[model samples]
Target: MTTKENNYTSLEVGTFESLLSRNYKGIEGKFFIGNELGLSGCEVSLNRLPAGKAVPFVHAHKKNEELYIITGGNGTFFVDGVEFNVQEGSLVRVAPAGARAYKAGDKDLYFICIQAQAGSLTQATHEDGIILNTKASWMNGKK
Candidate 1:
């Protein structure tokens, strides 16, 4: 007995790109955006941090969980007030409403970020000059 296989051809690929606005807290970079497959509560984006720059000051969220997977270069990862050295193939995860921040170490940094929660992700400045997480809902209508 022989089994039959189904063949599929490529038509088009789905891609999402969002331009960073001047009013945004972060610097300029291509944001490869996308929604989770078959799920409405999660989203993902790839961020490129240029040399001598930081992704976000230091922040926490209310209902969203974020993970950063470093794909190139080196960087300093700060989580919950603690610092960690991260490089290629590093994975850092921040829980809902957890404080975190990171900076590229002497070189450009490329990483994949995933966010899953009930609202949008945002950043705010704290009294001590530290960055804090506001709410993810702020991005609801802006997109």
Candidate 2:
């Protein structure tokens, strides 16, 4: 069944676009599931990096955490000065305070980045007894 509010056609059909802001260098991105999807607790995006290029700089978040899932090619991810090689199926998690950056391999690299604020989901849904109709808001265009 399809729900206009939340049911998206498919990631395969999702258009890959340049990252919204050009402030950063060496990366292109498309936001697949975001506020448009009625998501408040988390957001997802597809990131692509060309060979020999890397994210412009290392950065850390103040409230949100990020998880990166490598989908194609390979790359080196640096978190808080530590490096890790990532490839297809590799998953990396970075906490709010963990500085991070990455470089694409010889070939282009593609990955999915999922981000959410720490404790926001549980606090809003369970602890606060606020039932969020995340899907419905997408169709209605309001939350």
Candidate 3:
């Protein structure tokens, strides 16, 4: 029988070089992390919003819950029409059905958003019939 030696991978540690600009309608800013890291069972992103700009729309997930960790600047987070002030060190959690959005204040807003389906992380690994596929090029703009 053959055995695997390690189950970890390393990604570049800096954020400045990884930030990519993204815009939709009137919203605009940058994001630092994405699926390019091959993470499993969860999606993580570090987002930056320029002062006075907000996310394009309020959105909710059907099966996934999200946690936002505010790391810099200040912002107003709207969840179902209620406003909450968020700043560095603030952590917010939104359920799958809660609508949410945010607007940045005078300083640039930086936050990390992590989403995952409830209870999915506790499931068994490959030994329970799960299968891991080879890394695909879809996210890299390849055909």
Q: Which candidate number maximizes lDDT?
A: 3
TM-score of every model versus the real structure = 0.59, 0.67, 0.71
Arrange candidates, best lDDT first. Answer: 3, 2, 1
Compared with the true structure, what per-residue lDDT tens digits does model 1 show for residues 49-128? 66778865678887878988888878898888889988889998889767888887887777788887734545434533
- Report the C-alpha lDDT of model 2 over 8-102, residue by residue, as the tens digit: 53233333334433222334554455744566558887777777788878999999899999888888999998998989899998999999999
After superposition, which runs of candidate 3 have C-alpha atoms over 4 Å from their true positions?
1-6, 16-27, 30-34, 121-143
Error of 1 at 18 (Å): 13
Per-model C-alpha RMSD? 17.2, 8.3, 10.9
| Cα error, candidate 3, residue 79 (Å) | 0.5
By the TM-score metric, which is better: model 2 or model 3? Answer: 3
Poorest stretch of ten by lDDT in candidate 1: 14-23
List the candidate numbers ranked by TM-score, top first. Answer: 3, 2, 1
lDDT (0 to 1) per candidate: 0.66, 0.73, 0.76
Query: Which 10-residue span in candidate 3 carries the lowest summed lDDT?
Result: 16-25
